[model samples]
Target: MSNFLSGISITLSAIALAVSGWTAYQLSQLNLLIDQQQNTITEQQNTNTQQQDKITQLTQKIEQNKALISSDTTQQLNSVSTTSKAQNNVIQPGQFVRQGFDNKIKIELQSVKRIQNPDSEEKNVVVVQMRIRRIVPKGKVDAISLNQSRGRNPETSEVYRTIQNKSTSFTYINDLPQDSWGNAYFWLKVPEGINVIDIVIPETAIFEAVPISS
Candidate 1:
């Protein structure tokens, strides 16, 4: 009976040893899997951070480009407006001319042979021998004759011409003919409130006129 009991005890000890070994092996494998999962999660987080940084940088660059384009467009528009204003400075005859405030009126005369110097304090007005340039659509000859016979307001009135008469003390000489070079004359009266004289004309309106004397 003692021999039989000893054999049974030995057999139970061997079975317990095998079970302990298997449990240790399973614990080791579980630790390895946990470590690998942690490493993968860390790597994914780093990749996401890098992608976010790149997107922020790209957005900043796009904003800067838009600002540059807006600045360039504004500068170009200002340049064009300044050039247009500079060109509007010439006055002709027989056309509706406006210069200063009050929108004064005048009659334009062409082919002026002479301008008589008036004995007045104003140095702008002078009598001139002028011919008709362009008759207004519904205007009368008597209304246009005022330009040849009488003087207009000095503040807004101006006479554009090319002939320089040094012999007489005229402010300017009228020598441009209406039919020559598709040119027309403009005459305007000075307003009651203003005390300055200036002229303005579009560059595309007329090319140049012929000599009035010839």
Candidate 2:
């Protein structure tokens, strides 16, 4: 009986040791599973953070693009407005017009002849063949004789038999030569409100200023 009791005690001890070992192996497996789960959560969180950062960057880029577009649109609008204003301020002719900048009229005289008045021996009137080269719009033109000695009516542009009637504002034109071009001369005049900065006449008239010989 004593030996049998001792054998039973040894068997019970072996069974307890087996149970403890099995429990320890199960605990280790659970710990490994928990660690895996934690790692998966950490990876998901990192992915989400990266995605948010990208979204923020994209949003900033969109805002910058919008701002640039707005600025360009504003500039284009301003340019159009300025161009429109300039066009509206333009002036036309055949009416009263003002001359801006250094505007001038040019007239060319083709055939100039000295006409001696039979009644007046000392005084002579000049006839010029003239043509219009260029004139500002709304400008007026009439024949003018270049003798201050003759009587002149500034309003009617008429000449009378007086010593002061020699000078004239009107120009005379004659037919060109047979081989020449059309026969016509020009006279230059400026309209009211427009200024005659300068008058350029061709060198076809006698007693006119001579150009430098080139």
| lDDT winner | 2
Q: What is the lDDT of candidate 2?
A: 0.44
lDDT of 1 by residue, 72-140 (tens): 988998898876544333224543332211111222333322222233443332223323233122222
| Clashing residue pair totals per candidate (backbone < 3 A) | 11, 30
Q: At residue 5, give the lDDT of candidate 2.
A: 94
Per-model TM values vs. the true structure: 0.43, 0.43
- TM-score result, candidate 2: 0.43
Clashes of 2: 30
Residue 75 lDDT (model 1)? 92
Q: What is the lDDT of residue 201 in candidate 1?
A: 28
Model 2 Cα lDDT, one tens digit per residue, 15-54: 9999999999999999999999999999999999999999
For candidate 1, give the lDDT of residue 18. Answer: 89
Give lDDT: candidate 2, residue 197: 17
